[model samples]
Target: MLAKAIFLDIGGIVLEINWRKTVEALGVFDRSQQDQIWSVLGSAKIHLELERGNATPQEFFAFVRSELKLSPEAPLEEAWNQLILGPLPQVDQIFDRYAGRVPLYALSNTNRPHYDYFMKQFPVMKRFDRILTSFELGHRKPDSEIYMAAATEVGLSPSEIVFIDDSPANVDAAGRLGFRSFHSVNSVSATLEILQRHFSN
Candidate 1:
């Protein structure tokens, strides 16, 4: 089937964010402690709160510290920002290659600061056919409405589009809505190759 649209997730897919690195950066720790930190880090409820501006980074750190019973003196904000590093390399090159060839959109659960940061750092985001942000959209992923909103914004059926996200839940949600989806564990090179193969013929 021809791809009528492409939806990319910002945080993990286009931006190379290593969330576990935040816990590791907190200095050497035993396996048990690491496990505790990892557990808090993977909680979607925490991320949803963070992305919605309902919880500050400091609050998040406190919550994690409380969960792990770690020192309250931990450098939470810095450590959290450490995980949210810069964008992936050659992201623009990939976007440039595919932008106008097909309708392209970005769907992310991000806050105002990060959204502003991205717009300033990468002007190419402005080039997308549409940008659906949870902070702005009031709808987040793993929710069919967000995917439907994206499809509606682009005037395409979900089945005609491909959604790329780091979260399997989000991919599965889109899949249920008739979208062709991929979990973005592989490199963008792999993703581009897949898209090229599908459209080249």
Candidate 2:
């Protein structure tokens, strides 16, 4: 079946964001203690709260800093923004390869600071037909609500959309909703291969 719309995750698929690097930069390493830092570093509920527009990045980072026992004036603000190092190397090529075939959308689970920082710093992603983030939609991935919203944004049914993400759980969630989902682990080329093999023909 051909995908009428393609929804891709940003941090890992379209952008090379080293969330761990940001956590390490904050000097938080222990797994037990890393819980607080992990929330800001990975797909945790606290991070989702920020992406859901419940808390500003400043407020989120302030909470992280307080958990780490760092001063409010500490230079960790830049660390969160630094999570987005740059765009994925194959972004332009990938988009160009599939540009007019179907509407492409950024269905990311990210917050405003990181999103705004990347939009200005990495203008290449503007090529996507739409930008749908948890911040704007007020729902995160693995939740059927977000997937349904994405399908709505694309003006297609879940089965008509191909959603790709690096996380197996997210992919599984989308698959359960009838999407042609791909677990795109660390390679855009591989992601394209999956699309071509599964959805394109």
Index of the highest-TM-score prediction: 2
| Cα-based TM-score, every candidate | 0.75, 0.88
- What is the C-alpha local distance difference test score of each model? 0.74, 0.80
Tens digit per residue, CA lDDT, model 1, 53-157: 676656666676876567867766556655666667777766778877887889888766567666776676787788788766556788777788778877889
For model 1 the local lDDT of residue 169 reads 97
- In terms of lDDT, the poorest run of 10 residues in model 1 is 192-201
Query: Once superposed on the true structure, which residue ranges of model 1 sit more than 4 Å away at CA?
Result: 25-32, 44-46, 52-75, 121-127, 198-201
- In the range 1-201, model 2's lDDT, one tens digit per residue, is 556778899978988977666776677667666666576446555667998888787787777777677887777867777667787777787788777777888898888888878888888788898999988888888888999987887789988888889889999999999998888866888878877864453
Candidate 1: clashing residue pairs, number: 0
Model 1 lDDT vs. the true structure?
0.74
